[model samples]
Target chain A: MRQSSSTTDEKEIRETVAIILQNFSPLKENLIPILQSVQSAVGYIPQPAMKQVASFLAVPAGEVFGVATFYNQFRLIPPGKHPVKVCLGTACHVKGGNIILEEWKRRLGIDEGGVTQDREFSLDRVACVGCCALAPVVLVEEEVFGTMSPSAVEGILLRIRIEKERRSGCGGNEE
Target chain B: MKTITLTIDEKTVEATEGEMLLWVALDNDIYIPNLCALKARPLPDANCRLCWVDIEGRSAPVTACNEPVYNGMVVKTGTERVVRLQQTALELILSTHPVDCGRCGKNKRCELQKIARHLRTKLKQKRLRDISKRLPIDSSHSLFSYDPNKCVLCGRCIWVCKEEQKVGTLHFAYRGFAMVVTAFGGAPLGEADCTMCGRCVEVCPVGSLIFKNAEK
Candidate 1:
């Protein structure tokens, strides 16, 4: 049953890739846009999609992978439901950004650029988010929490846990 | 191509109008410290910022690899500002690189070491704290070994693999501090579709990529 389901997923991915590839000519210049469309459709650039792209463009798979990794915008893994990004820009670094990052890593039990075992959260460190005014900032999904401290990191994660529990109708007090 | 003359370091030199300043300077026996440039490849990667030169009119130093030569252009290859920028770039590259030059295969022949010495930059890595990921070495390929810790990410190997040789065996993976050059799909180099071409190793400026049988 698992093997059959995985085959179905592969078929789905191939269909998605075919639909996206039809719009653009298979030129070398179209690689970036093709990758962008695939990422947008699938939420991340899976290894299978990269292989499909390499064959479609008649380039080596290594070349495609290299180009993708050179840019900071590409993501290899599927992001968690609530993606966490900590700023490590020059301004943020000066404002104890590393301390806040350490707190997040400790609480999440994941290092930089890792997803939690439960897949509920993923942590990443960005060079900058263009909001330098809010130094030592952490972005959970689209909401930016500024002037973050180590204790505040705990508060944010706890809040997220409670919110998830509430939505699922399972409060902390429940056995 | 029409030949044009430009003033570099107060010395007049003749070069083709469309020739890159870096190559023209090198052809005339004028040294410009660079890492990602190759005489065979006309296109410049411009990833390494070590070849900055002060153009008379430009506000900031321009990479010699990307700057095209023009008639009557006055260029300063080494100035206080240029040297400082080169030093800063070298320091940043050194920060993530392992400082075990004594044991490295490239040791005395490393371009990074030569540039550091040329600029009088200290090799202590004190400016920026070291944040090395300490990635595992890949000695899977019978022809060569790839050590990420020694890599400077100059893009020379990638260019050689993709453009010159068209083998495309090596590619960049991840980004920012986690960035690394790896085989496709993160496969072992020996298991990939590698033809065992030594071009990547030949073009590498550091000991990150080296032939397995090379004399140690």
Candidate 2:
């Protein structure tokens, strides 16, 4: 994943903090929900939001940020336009989801849990999205694809590339 | 305060003043299966999808535990989708859980056993059974024994341990399916600074954490 300066824009930081405060009240034991809301509001958690959440929850800001970054679920970088989640849960792992994850890395030319240099895609692994029945699951922009294969990954990546091209007003087959 | 009228099992029921759909259906005697939800503390962690329901407006099966009641909501509590998701969630929870319910004290009283019976779910699917690596069961305490293998990560123990007893000894140690509720720093239950309060055992819906004195 690409890294931004630790000092984020103050306006965007305030907006993200405001969204978190709106989602959760300043009640004790609201830390989990507050962190979740903040992550959902801003694609990735900002350090400033962690400070605000710490003040709101009365916990140490370092503790809040530590907890936020502690879990693999939270991301510090702004994700790409499309988020690709590969299920690494037990069932899926047994069914070769990790292999599919590697395919994504190869096609995207980035490591797992890292975003492409162009920022067209961000790849992350999830413990499970509760879709184990659809083993070897991969989620692309909230849409779940089951039993994904290495061959299938190319098609999906090509589709995303084509969409990116279209959005930029460039003709298809430009890749 | 907003009110919502929704259909549960084809019966129209009204929920007032911000009620969870699971409670609404349960109030109307419409069975929306759940394990993580306790009447005492109702937070829609949505960790347990047993109360999964098919909502008209939602794309995927929205967990009744977490989803707020909306007006004119057409909810299906026992539809094919609900059954599939519920079965999946239950199966996932049971997969990692220890398979010694028959010998356990809460055999009949176990919520996991009851849910399996209710759903008529057989363990047909493949599961992760690694009994060789067990979390050390702490039965030294006079009140109860802690066996983490049977835990389903429902967070009920943590909820009750922290909320009712004001004992934050227990927390979700790991993330995702690897999650297990444990004392801070992986201390044994008795060794931890816990007050030996049995609220956790009392609130546990499953036999994961249980009263040792009650066992045969």
Best by lDDT: 1
The docking category that best describes candidate 1 is medium
Off by over 4 Å in 2: A1-175, B1-4, B123-133, B176-178
Model 2 lDDT tens row, B1-216: 877677776788888846777788888887777888876676646677788788886788877877778778788877787788778787777777766766887888888777777777864345545432276777866788988887877888777776767656677754555566766445567776678778888878877788877888
Q: Number of the top candidate by DockQ?
A: 1
* lDDT (10s digit) by residue, model 2, range A75-116: 877787678999999999999998999998888888876888
What is the per-residue lDDT of model 1 for residues A1-175, given as tens digits with 9 covering 90 to 100? 9899888978888899989999989899999999999888876788888899999999888778877777667778877778899999999999989998999899999988788988788898998888989898999988999999999988898898888777785543321
Candidate 1: residue B142 lDDT (0-100): 90
Q: Each candidate's TM vs. the true structure?
A: 0.75, 0.55
- Listed in order, the DockQ scores are 0.49, 0.05
Report the CA-based lDDT of candidate 2 relative to the real structure: 0.76
